[model samples]
Target chain A: MTRTLLGVVIAAFVVLRVWIWRRRRATGHERVRARWGPFAGDVGLVAGREMRERFRGKVFRVGTLLILAVVAAAIVIPTLNSGKAQPQQVGVVGALSAPLRAIVVASATSAGATVHFVPEPDRAAADRDLRSGRLDLAIVDGRELIVDKPPGPTGTSATAQFVRAVSNDLGVAEAVQAAHLSAAQASALAAARALPLQSLQAATTKGAVHTTSLIGLVLVFVMLSQYNTWILIGVMEEKSSRVIEVLLAAVRPIRLLTGKVVGIGLVAFAQATLIVAFSVALAQGVGSDLLHGTAPVLLASTFAWLVLGYAFYCWVYAAAGSLVERQDQVQSLAFPLSLPIVFGYIMALTAAGSGSASELFKVLAYLPPTAPFAMPVLVGFGTVTWWEFLASAAISIVCTVGMARLATGIYRRAILRTGRRVHLREVFSRAAG
Target chain B: MASLLELVGLRRRFGAITALDDLSFSVPGGQVVGFLGPNGAGKTTTMRAVFGLTDLNAGKVSWNGAAVGPAERRRFGYMPEERGLYPGMLVGEQLEYLGRLHRMSGTDAQIASKMWLERLGVGDRARSKVEALSHGNQQRVQLAAALVHGPELLVLDEPLAGLDPAGIDTIGGVLVEQARSGCCVLFSSHQLDQVEDLCESVTIIDHGRLVVSGRVDDLATTGPRRLVVRVEGDRDASWAGGIAGLMISEVNGGEARLVLDGDVDSDLVLRVAMGAGRVTKFVFERRRLSEVFREALG
Candidate 1:
């Protein structure tokens, strides 16, 4: 199943990449026109500069490597531990019956476990072996099962449930033999019919989905904060250094801001793609059940959210950056701006950990700031329909458009006002006045 | 022909402070105009307004008889008062990027950037980071960036500030060459001598208003002409004070400078000095731009 999903993802990526390449070639003349066009050329220039600087910077290289290392560790550790899992060991004493032994072995096999049964001289010897931890459970005189400790009443453990099934099968076989029925009757009595069961609600793959949700939330949180800060610091540096004056001379404020965000957005996207590809490939190679069934879907959702989250927050950060002329001011502003992100992250993380979506989380999924963190988790939990996902994404995009417009205004007004920090209220008032 | 650039009734206010008050000026093609003002006199504000960098409360900046817009502004180059360049970027690459922003093709931008750097005497330092360059070299790179796109109009603010004499001459020569190539050049400076040497015309502002503006020779000629007389003898030329309507502004040793009234003749002042002593020199001179600026401002 994982292999098929992996194949599909790889094929899709290749096809999209080729399609872009072919389109670029087919529209070569249009591309040239775009390069020389008034707005596009200016935007392209700024974006090109940003992309070049970021790709060549030490921070980007080191940060990506660090994240990849973390992802690899997260996948490899669980797989290695699962590979080293030990099977259950049982001990039997005093003429263990053939049917009983057969039932015990069959139950263990059905439970996805192996059992190694050893013969003991007496019940005392079986008890000693079990207590010494050489055996997981002991059967004395082929009648009673004993263990060092009692299994929980819920019987959720595979070993406990397997023992119960073995005991029930033995009881049925003993009753059939005691009835002294004919071969056909004995056989019919021993064969218990399976019970028919029905459930009104469909069962959810809770464990895998919950894990995917948590991973998605973290990725969105980290990518948004990191990249948004990059935009903030990047703009602040440009402004304080007064390089923005030079750039604004050549291009419009809106185009410059757009190019900056687009450039850094592409960098963020590239790093995210690399990390996701690494994770999926690593998970598949290690046969890790961590991202088993929903790996491809979860990854794609997380990436989409990353883009949305960045699009929503980058403008705010960029505008805030223009308001301040110093790095210290950025530090103070970053916390307040990150409040919604932090709030949404914690809530989404809590829901993901508990394997359930809260009502508040469902509401937050529609808000642009929190939706990047919440909607993906809701999707993971199967609580949100595809239409709901689309609605949330559409809402985020619309909000982002509004934010970009507002941010552009603030940035244009405040970027050149250098001296003390420019207040947001002042920017608005200045615009109005 | 229409003025290459014209600011008609430009007005801007920052809060209660009026940065520019009905400031109007024009620069013709192929001419270098000096934008001179005292500190806080709105010279920078006027230049920024020309490039549409500042919001004007009223008025318009017209380029070649049309309202200037981004497209026209893109064809224009500006070096702001507070000079800035990305310190982390390579000098050549930064200029090329800026050229591209001005709508130059990639290859064209690259070639132009390289050529400008070479012309500015920083061609060998193209690969060096901006921060790695000396202050003078960085200023050169800044100029190169402004000119890399071959803009039709160049507006520079304090382009000669903080430069050594040699650096000043180099940049001054570059601006002259730009003007000679038919690019309209307007720059502001506190250094009147440099302005006198480079600018064909000047616009002087004070208190956010134009105090004086005209061709350099025209402005000087419009001011009072002085008759300077230097006698061969060591005797003082106090006799110049006796001449009617010829106010002797200065008389020291054998030399005297007299400001003639409208009805007075400069030759009369010289003849009077020649009679007072054996006159070795006699000249009629227009007031220096610096003197004219001080007189206008005062």
Candidate 2:
């Protein structure tokens, strides 16, 4: 399953590249027309500078390596610990009936375990073997089950489950043998089936899907926080360094701001793609069940939300960055801006982990700010339809356009106002007046 | 015809304070004009308005005879009062980037960037990060960024504020050459003497209002003439006091500097000086630019 996912990701990248190339070719005439147009080559130049700076920065390189290392460990460690379960050793004292032995073996199979039996000379020997941990469980004279520790009430552990299964199956077989008047009756009792179950509502997502959703939510949260902060700091750096004044002289504030956000967004997208691709490939290579049986739609939803979430939050961060001229000011502003993101991430996490999307969670899926995290989980749970996802996306895109305009306005008004922090109220009031 | 840049009725307000009030001036092509003012005299604001960096309350910036727009502004280069450049970027790359932003093609930008860096005497440091250069070197790079695109109107704010004498001479020479090449160069500086040396004309503003502007020689000569006399071993200015409409502005050892009205006879003042003692020196001269600047502001 992971291998297929890896292949799909690689193919998607190739398809995206080809589509971009074709789109460029299609837009060639338009680009030519725009070459002599106003603000031509502005955004590309800005984005290129940003990409170069980020790629050159040591922090980006080191941070990506660290995250990859952690991701690899998360994938590999589980597989190593849970590789192949050790066989359960069971001791039997006195004469063991053939039917009883068969029942014990069958019980172990039902518990997803294997058993090896050892004959004990007496009860004391069986007790000694159980005490010494040589035997996981023992049967005393075909009557009682003995173990080093008492089994859990629900038999949650592997050993406890195996012991419980063995005891119950053996007891049932003995009772059947005693009650049976004919062979057909005993066989019929042994083959009894459970009644069919039904539910009125739709079934929730399976455990694998739930796990995938949780991972997607985490990726969204981490990526949003990381990239939004980059935009914030990048703006602050330009402002504090006073390089913005030079840039604004050559380019319009709107064009400059647009270029900056687009540049940083590109870097963020590229970094995210690399991380996702690395994770899928690592999981596939390591034979880990992480992301196993993950639905393609769920992966797409996660990536889509990532883009949408970035689109929604980047402008806010960029605008906030323009208001301040100091690193300390950036810190003070960043926390308040991140409040909504943190809230949405936590709420989405709860819904994904619990495998249940509440009404509020569903409502959050429609809001642009929270939709990036919420809508994808709804997709994972199969609670949100395709149209619903599109509606939420459309809403987010609309909100993002509005946000970009507002942010551009604020950035334009405040970026050149150096020395002191510019207030949002000041910008808005001036615009209104 | 060489292009002319004009700022007409430019007005701007920062809350209650007016930064530029009906400020109007013209920078003719093939000339270097000094934008002179004290601190907070709207020089920077006016320059920013030229590039549309500052929102004007009212103004029209025109080139030649048409109102300047993005296309015209693209042909203009500016060095802000507060020097700004990406500290982490290579000097040559930074210049190239600015050149490209100003509409130069990639190859043209590269060539111009190299030429400007070499001309600014920072050619060896082109590959170095801007932050690694000395302050003067960085300032040169900043100037190079503005000039790299061969702008028709080069506006610099305090371009010579912190330069050493050699740096000043280099930049001053560049400005003169740019003007000779038919570019209109407008720059603001607090160095009055340097302004006098470099600018062909000047526009002086105070409290966001234009005080005086004209050809440097015209403005200086239009001010009241001074009559300077040196006596043989006499330190008193009583010789010049006998002449009507003559006021002694200064009296040093054996020398008296007098301000004369238009009707005052400079020949008679010299005669009076000769009668008082053996005259060593006599001359009539217009006020210096510094004197003109101070008297205009006062």
Which stretches of model 1 miss by more than 4 angstroms? A1-40, A85-205, A430-433, B1-3, B227-284
Per-candidate RMSD vs. true structure? 6.5, 5.7
- Cα lDDT tens digits, model 1, A12-125, are 669758754764474211122222223356666677678768877899889888887877887787666546446678888877877778777777776656778888888888
lDDT of each: 0.82, 0.84
Predictions' DockQ, in order: 0.36, 0.43
lDDT of 2 by residue, B1-298 (tens): 9889989999998888899999998999999999988889999889989888888889899999998787888899999988999989888778878888887886677778778888989888877899999999999999998999999999999999899999999999999999999999999998989999999999999988999999998987886788788989688878677788888888988788889888987888888888888988898877777888888899
**DockQ of candidate model 2:** 0.43
Query: Number of clashes in model 2?
Result: 0
Candidate 2 local lDDT, A45-141, one digit each (tens) = 7777776677668887887788778667766776665554788898988877887888898899988788898999988988988999999998877
Q: Which ten residues in a row have the lowest lDDT in candidate 2 chain A?
A: A28-37
> Would candidate 2 be rated incorrect, acceptable, medium or high by CAPRI criteria?
acceptable
Which candidate achieves the best TM-score against the true structure? 2
True contacts kept of 1: 0.49
